[model samples]
Target: MFSGAQLSLYPMSDDFVGIITGALSALDPHRDHLRIETDDLSTLIVGPPEILFSAMRDLFVAAARSGTHCVLSATVSRGCPGEPDDPICTPAEGTLPVAPLDERIAKAVAAVKAAPETGQPVACQVSLYPLGVNQHMDEIEGCIAFLKASGVFDRPKNFCTKLSGDAGAVFATLQQAFTRFGAAASHVALDVTVSAHSPTRA
Candidate 1:
């Protein structure tokens, strides 16, 4: 299976360039673990799920620490058909196997509870698509149940679910949503947007 994300960070300030460049350092710790490439549009990170989300959290937190509003847009996927399988995209050790819907939900909730706190808080909205599956709705609803119980869940939006909390748990929940709902080898994708230090609040 191939897993990766195409991520773009946007800082709402005149120093966007500086903020973005400085935040790139946050990816240093994860560099050896992932295949990272940057271009004019976005950065591509390919690796295990745990490392992928952690790297993203670090980068976003770094930029947000500047007290500037920052938004991260990413398209994350696993088992993509067009992509060749790479050993680097291997699943984490002891990753949960596909199980009954209820079992997966319980485990996902436990993961969120166990996530390490990163001090920085963020708000994320995401939509999951489990393609080419007859039980797609079941998978989606199962993910919804998991999110509501994740502690970071904020609310349900029109087309996606909203989550807010420490960056760690929020990203953990996102990882769970990506990995747990779909079939073990099926194509699953997530459209996610995360924000920090936004001036406008509800």
Candidate 2:
């Protein structure tokens, strides 16, 4: 099984260059664990699900810490047939090593916690796809219920759900969704887009 994500970062500030570079730099340490490619549009990262999520957590945190408004949009998938047949696309025999979901979630929560509070909450739109699963709709509905009950979910939209709150809460809610549904399901994909310092700074 192979997992990957294509992500784009948009820092809503005059000093966008620094914010973007800083986030990319944060991913440098994980280069050994993932195959990373950055083009004009977005950055592609391919690796085990755990590593992929970890890298995303770190990258988003670094960008949010900039204190400037920003958005990180991503599409995550696993077992994609369209990808090139490379080592990154093929996992060795036996189960691929994956970090504990709790560990990964904690890291993300920490990053959000450390971000400078702009007194303005952030929002994120998340869409989950449960691939090759029996009763996928049931799972999706369950996850949506969880998000809504969490008080972070803004509303339910077709093909996706919206979340708005402080950065930490927003990220924590997202991690829960991934772990509860994405990780538990036999195969799952996620599309997540997050905006910080939302509603625009007047």
Candidate 3:
């Protein structure tokens, strides 16, 4: 019942890093840059000896291996005050949303930047998020090749082979590339997300 408590842990050792990392990774993909502020998000885990024992033991073993002995505790902002709430952990190193491989990739995405209401092109930068970075290289190459061959774009060597049309075209092309690249590797947790120009009221 740790609803309004902050969950915090004292680092026991490098071994605990895995336990923390694993827990966070298993929970939220956006777990990173935790702090003792309102913005910080963590899972409050508190309970009897058996509840927090196993994970804590893992942390302890990790600390032992790491040659460090630190205490760790995290409280939740909303939950039962007496019992441990679900672990709300954010990873220390989460995946970056931008997966731009090279200058050419950036150029390719920029080339298809979204236009504004004035029907005029606005300068924009595109960021790619490559998931499952270590996967089938050949498949990745194939997707890029297909995009390049299909895009029919030249002159700007930096330009990507993204479908040259509107913002949607570029997005669609990127997805298509991922689908093609993920061949056979069903767990290919890799892909890129291009944030279109942010929408703001005039």
Off by over 4 Å in 2: 83-121, 149-152, 165-169, 172-176, 179-187, 200-202
Candidate number achieving the greatest TM-score relative to the actual structure: 1
- lDDT string for model 3 (1-202, tens) is 1212234444444565564554443222222312223234544333321223223233323332333444333321222234343343211122212333443344434433431122211111221223344655644554465555434222122423222333334433443333233322232322221221224301
lDDT of 1 by residue, 116-136 (tens): 998998999999999878999
What shift in Å separates residue 100 of candidate 3 from its native position after superposition?
26
Q: 179 in model 1: Cα distance from truth in Å?
A: 1.1
TM-score of model 1 (CA atoms): 0.97
Q: Record all residue pairs in model 2 with backbone atoms less than 3 Å apart, i.e. clashing.
A: none
- What lDDT would candidate 2 get against the real structure? 0.69
Q: Return the lDDT, model 3, position 86.
A: 32
| Of candidates 2 and 1, the better by TM-score | 1
Better structure of 2 and 3 per lDDT: 2
Model 3 segments more than 4 A misplaced: 1-135, 152-165, 191-202
State the number of backbone clashes in model 1: 0
